[model samples]
Target chain A: MIQNVTLVGAGNVAWHLGAALEDAGLVVDVVYSRNYSNAKALAERLYDAVPTDSLDFSESKSELFILMVSDNVVQQVAEEMTLPSSGAIVVHTSGAVPLEALANAGLYVGVFYPLQTFSKGKKVDFSKISICIDSKSERILDMLAEMAYKLSKKVYHLNSEERRKLHVAAVFACNFTNHMMTIAQEVMESNGMHFEMLEPLVRETVDKAFAIGPDKSQTGPAIRGDSKTIGKHLEELDGKARYQEIYKLVSESIAGIEKE
Target chain B: MIQNVTLVGAGNVAWHLGAALEDAGLVVDVVYSRNYSNAKALAERLYDAVPTDSLDFSESKSELFILMVSDNVVQQVAEEMTLPSSGAIVVHTSGAVPLEALANAGLYVGVFYPLQTFSKGKKVDFSKISICIDSKSERILDMLAEMAYKLSKKVYHLNSEERRKLHVAAVFACNFTNHMMTIAQEVMESNGMHFEMLEPLVRETVDKAFAIGPDKSQTGPAIRGDSKTIGKHLEELDGKARYQEIYKLVSESIAGIEKE
Candidate 1:
């Protein structure tokens, strides 16, 4: 029933999702962006899609409008927009934000969060990414579910509270883990080793998580109660106070797990 | 040249590495273990391989003997065994042990640290795992390099000091990251939510690391300096003092990265 869809941002998520929706035989009405070049770039990749400015959508011809803007600006963008009516489904692709922001504007609101990281140049396979959906109305929810299921194999109807909880887990699992990798890369790069050398280990760590639960799959000197190695590493860390502190904290945590 | 390789441990690393070597056309000669069943279990997987408690190996029998025992016993095992000759390669699959332990035995000594977390009941793919090799002699080093390359796509010829440094990074990247995951799972599980729900987020976190360098790829309320969300997560964590401390410490680290 999703006849026409309008995209209101031109960032990484928008670029990927627009292509996916179009590829699935959905009619993409118009794609808008404050940055004309970004919008045009995404629009050029989609069939029968036109790059347009905000003024072009004044008529609100589409049945659904997806605002793939930054999380901080989602509310502001919703407030600044004029919509067709209170019936059209409006959704934002932010993992953290609730659908209430769109509801306050008297428009049918929902969330269409694709649970994966997006990089501008990287090709994302939507089939593998999980999609989290939420909406105020059951009808809109059904529509969103259909659209989401077409793109991803896994779709969850997470309430705002549950979605927020998932978002927090996401921060720990995805964002913080990546920061740890960054620290590893920095440590190696400072010693004249390429960051690419860590890629195999990084991939293997993730692969292990999928195979065995993280708790049982955990391994290192910290778990083995080998303080000799831990002390040596702390000394090697030297002046990097943050890295040393992290090593201490994580080692202590690993030691606790072993104790339990 | 690694026609017959002897594995001197029956743990997970030894089990997986021995299997990989056999699969790669290298004949695994003998699997020696203190626990007879563990050795037999691993040896059963390889053709023409036998498990034994035999500590004595006649000189010039096997070309390479992989000491995959626990770190604490590696030195003892090296001292107790009779290696082939100075030309025979003696390698221990430990990240922390010094190569001189085997060198003191009047044979070629090296380290074959497979940079991965191995767990029983789960199969591993050696094609992607990184093997860090260290040796005192060039001939032994070349042979180890050839074997490592045959088993894995990535093999690094690092000295003992550099291998030790990389091991420290592995602790941060793999073991520490897995602990963080356990924390995330604990937080959700205690709140009457299933840990399975966090799987999508966990997968995305690792996939994101592969896409961009972890530092630049990181995104969260902490990185964005949104104290409101961080405070909310702390409140949600409640009486879990350790998780709260970790959440705070990691958030501060993310914020510090932004400041840098």
Candidate 2:
């Protein structure tokens, strides 16, 4: 039952968490960022939030401070932040940084990482998003779990080591996967074909991968041992050396795994 | 109205397309495959479908013949099958093959490539699937359109070249993308982590990709220009030379694209 909150940073993560927290019955009283206009822009969206560029929270009444800054700046901002008057539970929404990064910043420090890709102006369904929370203190962990359970049904209590692994895995599963799609889009658009034509196929790929395990759900020439189709594809990508390299490496990797 | 369909090659494509066509009120009368058991297994699910290992269709009263064989065998089977008594429209469900492959085999020939992956046991929703149709004759194209439109709202009349481009793009988008997920799954599972933990992140990645274009939706350490995080990931993957190569290459490619 955290009543008031202070959200740090005005980027995609901050904007999303600020709105979701407010909608979930918590009051986001202050929005802070180094840039004044950005702080004002995000703060304006909340019910009665005040905007400030200063890091001082000495006069604020917010019981929870969420640091939604970039991974590089999380530790710096947490150390520079002037703790609130209320012995507030300060947390960062980063999957990479450990909870010890905020050890000296506040009495009760924790990590509340929302496992979703947030782009500004895009509406995210918080209910479907998973939240990974961690804290050293039992009392803070219980509080973190309660606040997280309000936003999503999926909440995992992962430690620093586990969270880092999760982050690395995400780098492969989500970030790398999206890059593959981007490469496909660039290739198709350059060849005078509509990239959207592959929409149904892309959706079906993801649906199948999750419906069955990725190992069982794999399709295409690489797995089927059809080198003819693979040869045609490689020939097509020959002009683009980078795409050709990726295609060759990944295809050979797939064929290699099948042999095992 | 294409009333009766004589489905050839009772594989994954035939198992799905046959049931979908039957459910759309078209009758599937005969299913032929090199293997009699596979034909029987699929044909038994349809209404009044006769399973046979022979390729002859001279005695069958079918109006449409669909070849659902592999890409390598599609053209060969198209040339080998005996023409049915009713002079049916012969089509192959292959993205790689051209419509002219069936030119000497039947009076009416076309392509009815359903643009989705299919497994024998998995249930597929045909309405969401896209069907790509092509034919030299307007009459055959119209008949193909009539039947395709009944099963799905998305029906594209892409020529052979465009269809080939589509197949190539699918290799990058669907096939390669799923492989990325598979790699991530292997990495996670080998490390004593549950692969399903990445489900929410994967779903969100796809949702964001299609909602906005993939270029704008791309988010990660590489895209964010966070080389330190990328370095950490590479270090984690250093033991697996193949994975390390993939990580370094894809990340460098993403960084290169951003510079461009």
Candidate 3:
């Protein structure tokens, strides 16, 4: 059981994870951040968890420490923290960084990555999020697995390499998809059309991808090699050079998929 | 009132439109298609609607004729169908085709494009989808608008030029987004990871794009010029050479956005 937990960040992931842990009946022992106010705000919602701005190595006192800081800060934060005991486990919620970074501290370290992008001021459904866990020791891995299973139905014992691969996949799926949507919104708005018009299609595309997976569910003019429609779309570009290029590139890519 | 409607072809669009219209208390008087079973199945969904397989010009007989056939078949469907009445309104549900194709038949012609990607066996929330309407006559346009408003909250009186532009935008927002998701799924499954793991991130990326728009919300290794991680990711790519190239291209594009 994850009885007491310490959260070492106050970003979107930290806020949601802190609240989720508390809701799961775990005691969030303390919340720490360089920005004391951010720590306090998250702590206030975490069932009496104490909030502090202190980075003192002397304060490492929880059974589980969750580092929810940015990817760039994960290593520095890990280096500065002092564990209360070698028995305590330190984990960072980052997709990139190796598990070995925690080894030099001579503590039981692992990763507790929530495979989700969190936004501030929005509630997260942890049940839908996958938790990727990896630890230096079997005993620590077991404890992390137990905690992850409590929060999510899907849990994976991924090493640094696998996690890094997954992160790259996430870039393609999440980041690229969002950019595509943004381009679509820009195109619609430029035509005096409302962006909301694409909302149903957007929602459906995601739902369908989840339902049948993406391979079989894919359909469009590009996949069909309907060059007439593609040509018309390109002509409709009317001097918007970059967007037209994107349209051509993506369509050609989809066409290539069809060829295979 | 769009009391009497004639469906000129039995297909995905026709089936959906007939059902929605019947549910909204309109009369689908006749459905004509080369495939009798399809026409019959659609007509059966409507109250007392007749299904006809006639291609003869003498059989024309309805207030509104909707040709919901394929893009290539639409023009042919329109050319063969004689208007039941000289003043009867004719419309087609196509994003790319001009409303003018429904002309030359000596009837009031227009377009009634429900701006959504339709799939058989999938139930859609029509109320949220936008309907694009255009007619040769203002009275016909008003009637189309009212019918559209009955089914949805959004109704746009887009001319052929504007509707063509919207179609091009749809290719980006709907079609291209789907392709990106397909690639993401491919990358994950080709690895040891399950496609389900990427769902949360996919949903969040979309939510964030809408919240801040893509241009400002973009954040990835590429945008940050974190070439170290990018190189690591490239090294991690197992056998998906196409995906790696896509990753490189998109990353460069994101870097360009950051520079701008």
Candidate 4:
């Protein structure tokens, strides 16, 4: 059983995860960041956590170390960290980085990736989030699973490759979908239409996608092969080159899928 | 006041709209479809509705005619329909087609576009749907708005150009977003991952998009300009040429937006 955790970043993920861990009665010993003020701000919220900008974990005694840093610095931070040679499990809260990224940091290494978008000041209901975990050993896996279950109702034992694949899928589902919305908002704004008008349509679209499978739920001029409507829409987007390219490509893709 | 409605299609939209009109205590005198059985099915559910596959309205007495057909056939259907040449108002339930498409058919022409996706078996609450109405004159617009208000709480008086622009925006917000969900589901299914795992993430993504504006809520390696992670994801999509192109283009677009 992991009683205490050392949080290794103070960004969005860490801010939420640290709070969740504390809520689950887990002790957070230290909150570290490259910037001391960030670490201090997060550390003050915990029950008993020291804030520091140091890589030296010599004074910090914790069973679990969660490196919630950016993907690029995860390896560098893991390499620079000093932890006990035994009995300490080092994990990174990254969807992209594999467990091997933290292999050299501790005796037991794993991933404790929470699959949800985190934003500062926005409260995340951890119970709704899926926590994907992987470890090098069965014992470590079970330990991480137990820890994860405290924070989330959905827990999965996903290996590096499976988690990475899930991450890429997430980018399409969340990131790309959000970008499409951005473009939609831009289209509405450019035409002097209020963005709120699209809300009902947006909600219904997603509800339909989930109700019927997206492939079957697909509806539009592209799927219907209404060239006239598609042509008019293209003309509507006359000078917006980037949007035009996207519209043409995505419509072609939808048509291709419909044919299949 | 328009008390009687002649519904000129028996598809998803017509099915929902017919029921809503009847619920509002407006009489639905007829339900027409190219297929007799479809018309019969919908007509059976309404009070005193005549199911016919004919364009002849000489036998039918109704104050309003709603041509809820496909966009491509909307104009064609309107041209073929025979309605009262003076008092009866004509409208098409389409976001794309302009009012002119129905002008020559009836003395008073307009649009009664319910901006929400409808499925035959699924019940739609009209109150939540935004009904976009437009007409050639204020009197006609007011008439359409009154009828629309009986069904939906949200109603807008959009001109042809504004409605067309809204329709294009809907394509991005609804159709394109659905396509993104399709791609994400495909990726998950291809990797032996159950698509249900994405449901929470999908719901949260949309919630976040609405909570904060889509542009501000954008989160991903692409928006962060993390090329290393982007390159890694591209490597993961290796042989899927279409998906790779989409990932590249969308990521580039996101990066470009982030820079601004």
Candidate 5:
């Protein structure tokens, strides 16, 4: 049962997680960021959270310290931070980084990776988000799981490798899907069509994909093996080599999946 | 003020469109399908629609004839169908086939394309769908627009070429996005992870993509040019050459997009 917490980094994930934690009756003791103003802004939103640029935690007695910084800086920040040897659990909110990245931080380390995309000004409902947690000790895992359950109903005890694989899957699902949408928007905008016209279709595609597994719900010229339509689409994207390449590759992949 | 209509074909599109037309108070006078049972099943759901296997519309007196057949057979059906020469408007509900495909139908021809992904047994709300209409004559366009407005608030007067372009974009936005989701699901399933864990992320990805244009909202290792993480992901997809290829190409494309 973690009662008090300290947040490191004041970016999108940190801001949202900090707010959710505070709302769940946890006291946020401090928020540390290289950009002091960012830390100050985020800290202002929580109860009795002091914003500071310092890495020293000797003066505070928070039960948990969460490193919510970027992937490149997590290990560095973890190495530099000084925490109590035995009492507080240190965790980083990253899907890509392994628990070993914080192993040398001289504290009981764990991962509290929330598997969801965060936007700065948007308020996220944590209940719908999956929180992936892993720790070296059973006691620490239980404590982290309890804390995670307070914020999210969907909590998983994923190890480092599983969490990393999940992150890769997320890249394909969320990141690649968004890129496909960008290509669609470009195609519409180039032809003097409004992007909003594709919104309903977009929503239906996602809904159908989830309802009946994406493989089974696959449609269009590619899966139909209609080379004529594929040719026409390629012709439509003649000058844009990048777009053509992506279309050809993905379409062929879909065709391959269908063949299997 | 188009009211009485006859539908040709009884697939997913025909099923949904026929229901929406009937619910909007339009008389579906007849339905024709090569598969008599399909036509009969659909026609039974509508108001006073007679099911027939014959292409001949000589016995029917509907004001409008809508060809809701597949793209390969749209022209063939149009060339064979017999309709009232002067008053009845002949149209096809196709995004890929042009207005010219209906030119030889020997009537006032037009397009009544509803830009949406239709699945069998799924009842879609017509109000949110966009209906794209086009015709050679002002009178026919006005009548089609009026009928379309009955089913959808979002109606666009796109010409054949523009509609075809929109269809291509739909392939990317809807079909390709769904394929990316398929890959994600495959990754998760292979790793013994439940697909539902990805649902919220998928929803948020679409929401963010729409809120801020997908190109601007794009995030991930690829856009960030984090070569180390990209390398790790590529290595992770080792044996699956197809997945590896797609991941590399899309990541490179995203990196390229970021450069520009």
Candidate 6:
């Protein structure tokens, strides 16, 4: 079992994951960032955690090193980290990155990605989130499974390819979903209405989608193929060609028409 | 004030709205549908509502004729209804149709469009939904406002133009949102994974969007301009041109590239 961990970055993921691990009874031994203040700020959140600017963990007694850094730097940071080679486990909290990124950095390298979006200062219920863990060795994987089970109710052993697919799906489900909301807000504000008025509808739609399946919960002119209403909506778009294009293409897709 | 109502359809909106009106102390006098069975099915839910397949309302003592029919039939239903002259108010519960559609049927015509996507057997809290009411005359508008207030807290006097925009926005925020979920679901299921694992991330994404505004809630490779991740994602969608196209266009839009 991994009893202690060193957070290798001070990002939103690092902050949240670090706190959740601490709450799960694991000792967060050190927090490190290129910027010392950021490391110090996050380190201050945990009990008796030290903050460091360097990647050298030669002096610390941490059994695990968790790379909460950006995807671009996951390999770089892993390569730079001072590992003891035998007793330590190195893991990254990235969905886009593969487990092999840290292969040369430590003897036992793995992935500890939580499939959720985190923002600075915002609290997340880690207990409800899905944690996807992957590793080469069975022992390390078992250790990860045990550690993850402590922080969340849902834990799965997903490989690099599966994690990449999940990451892409997340991009659509979360990022594109938010962009759609932004479009709705722009449409409302442009027409002298407040976006807040649509909150109940938005909330209800989401609830209904999950309650029934998403494929079965679909409604509107698009799915119904009410072309007249669709035409009128497109006409209403008038000058905003961008929104009109999206509205048209998405509507077509919903109606099961592609290659047009 | 409108005390009794003649519900002009037996669809999902009519089913939910009829219940809400009765709960708000208004008498649902009649439930009508072209199919007599559908009318009876919904009518059975009310305390004393009569189910009818007839368009004539001359026999009923309903003061408000609420047309909850399909958008294409709103004007046709209004014309077919055997409305009583002068005292009776005619209104259609549609976001697309104008109040003028019911003008020839009665002296008072308006809209009582609740901005919501209702599903049968799925209960919604009416008080949280927005009711967009509009009429040409002040007295009729006030009557609709009074009736709406009893049903919901958020009431807005939106004209037909504004209501159209609101409807389009609903299409994006609700329908398009659900479609995105469907895309994510398909992605997961086809990749040897269950969509339920994504529920936590989906829920958090929505919560964040509403807590902080949607404009400020966007996070992904698209917004970050992470070309490597974007290329990897596009490559993952290989051979699925429809999804690849969407991924490209939406990513470009998020990156603020409208024309190119």
Query: Residue B161's C-alpha lDDT in candidate 4?
Result: 95
Best model number under TM-score:
4
The superposed Cα distance between candidate 2 and the true structure at residue A30, in angstroms, equals: 1.7
CA deviation > 4 Å runs, candidate 5: none
lDDT of 4 by residue, A12-125 (tens): 999999999999989999999999999999999988999999998875669998999999989899989998645688899899998888877767889999999988857889
In terms of lDDT, the poorest run of 10 residues in model 3 chain A is A53-62
TM-score of 3: 0.89
Q: Which residue pairs overlap in candidate 5's backbone?
A: none
For model 3, the superposed segments whose C-alpha errors exceed 4 Å read A29-55, B34-54, B210-219
Count clashing residue pairs per candidate. Answer: 1, 0, 2, 0, 0, 0
Alpha carbon lDDT of residue A54, candidate 1? Answer: 71
Using Cα atoms, each model's DockQ against the true complex is 0.57, 0.71, 0.56, 0.79, 0.80, 0.74
Off by over 4 Å in 1: A30-58, B48-50, B58-60, B84-87, B187-208
Task: Say which prediction, candidate 3 or candidate 4, comes out ahead on TM-score.
Answer: 4
Q: Write the per-residue lDDT of candidate 6 for residues A81-161, one digit (tens) a residue.
A: 887544699999999999889978878889999999898756999999999999989999999999999999799999999
Order the candidates by TM-score, highest first: 4, 5, 2, 6, 1, 3
lDDT of 1 by residue, A1-260 (tens): 88789898988788889988987889788888988888898888888778886734557678888999877788888777777753577799887787786766545789999887776666777887778899878998999999998998788888887777777777777777877787887877777776777776766766676566677778888888988888999998999898888888888987897797
lDDT of 4 by residue, B103-191 (tens): 67867888999998777666788888999999878998998999889888899999999999998889988889899889888888999
Candidate 3, lDDT over the whole model? 0.80
Which clashing pairs does model 6 show? none
Model 3 per-residue lDDT tens digits across residues A1-260: 56888898988888898888877778888899999999998888877888888765365557888888767778888888777754577899888888987776546789999988676655778887889999868988999999988888888999987888788888878777777776777778887877777777788778878887766666667876778888888898868676676777788778888788
Candidate closer to the true structure by TM-score (higher is better), 1 or 3: 1
Scored against the true structure, residue B157 in model 6 reaches a CA lDDT of 98
User: Cα deviation of A64 in candidate 1 (Å)?
Assistant: 1.8
Clash pairs, model 4 backbone:
none
- Judge the docking of candidate 6 as incorrect, acceptable, medium or high: medium
Please, what are the lDDT tens digits per residue for candidate 5 over residues A1-260?
Answer: 89989999999888899999988889999999999999999999888999999998986789899999989889999999988655678899998898999988865899999999888756788988999999989999999999999998999999999998899999999999999999999999999998889999999888888888888888888998988889888988889898899899999999999788
Worst 10 residues of 6 chain B by lDDT: B251-260
- Which stretches of model 2 miss by more than 4 angstroms? none
